[model samples]
Target: MSVQEWSADAATEIVRAHSGVRGALLPVLHALQERFGHLGPEATRLVAKELNLSRADVHGVVTFYSDFRTAPPGRTVIAVCRGEACQSCGSRELERHAQHSLGIGFGETTADGSVTLDQVFCLGNCALSPAVQIDGRLVGRVDADLFDRLVSDAAAR
Candidate 1:
């Protein structure tokens, strides 16, 4: 979606409110991402202009942060943790299963656009290894069948 379609009032308010704060780029970008799903090129330009920074500077910040999304995410996000703890518990195998099942690899959406897959380092639930997050909810000990069920449930949502 075009950034012009975003809430200009909200964007203005966000920039105005945080313009004076040091290191405000991340928070501002996060707020915009939360509101609009991702930070498109237009939004980045607007932000840079409002903050008296260069577009390259804005792009640099966005690219530097993994949490900052540059495109719209699908309705459901299927993220699998790739950290050592999760990998030890078979996250790599699960990843392959998910990719094959969804017909998409990391940072991609399915053909029907029902879900977007991503690779995360850690879900912060190491004890519950082989972690998978469906729409922000942490799931653990996920096998192929179980992961398939989780994907189906998330798509249903």
Candidate 2:
């Protein structure tokens, strides 16, 4: 089935599944994103109506959390750590190299939808300083070369 059809059906099922729980908004949003890869307008509207919230309220919740995506992500996600520790260890240079190589800034996906670049404050690997998470696997001490390799590996996958 197409993503749109799946999104509509999944949104309805998720709203119904979580409607009875207290503070169901977050869970419902997470479920929708999990099933559909993102929360578009249709899912947001459905959640708002089911939970007695305004579209703005639902949209606010979705936007407030960095984990949520309003649109589908690329085939791979690259999250770079931007914490002070990582910054001190040359994360800035790595970030620049990544942007140049991918031709997209943070929070943007490649035109071909192969990769998405994202920034995270920390990956809890400060000891390694320049840390990056590619598809949820943490790699530390990432230099420009390492970053390139990681991106290449993700694309290959």
The predictions' CA RMSDs to the true structure, in order, are 2.6, 2.2
Q: Put down candidate 1 lDDT per residue, 1-157, tens digits, no spaces.
A: 3333587777888788886789898889987887788899988988999988999999999999887888888788889899999988888898899899899999998777688999999999899889989887999888999998987787776
Predicted model with the maximum TM-score: 1
Point out where model 1 deviates above 4 Å: 1-5
How do all models score by TM-score?
Answer: 0.92, 0.91
lDDT of 2 at 111: 99
Q: Which stretches of candidate 2 lie over 4 Å from their true place?
A: 1-5
Positional deviation of 91 in candidate 1, in angstroms? 1.2
Per-residue error for 134 in candidate 1, Å, reads: 1.6
Tens-place lDDT digits, model 2, residues 24-68: 888888777777888888888888888889999999999999999
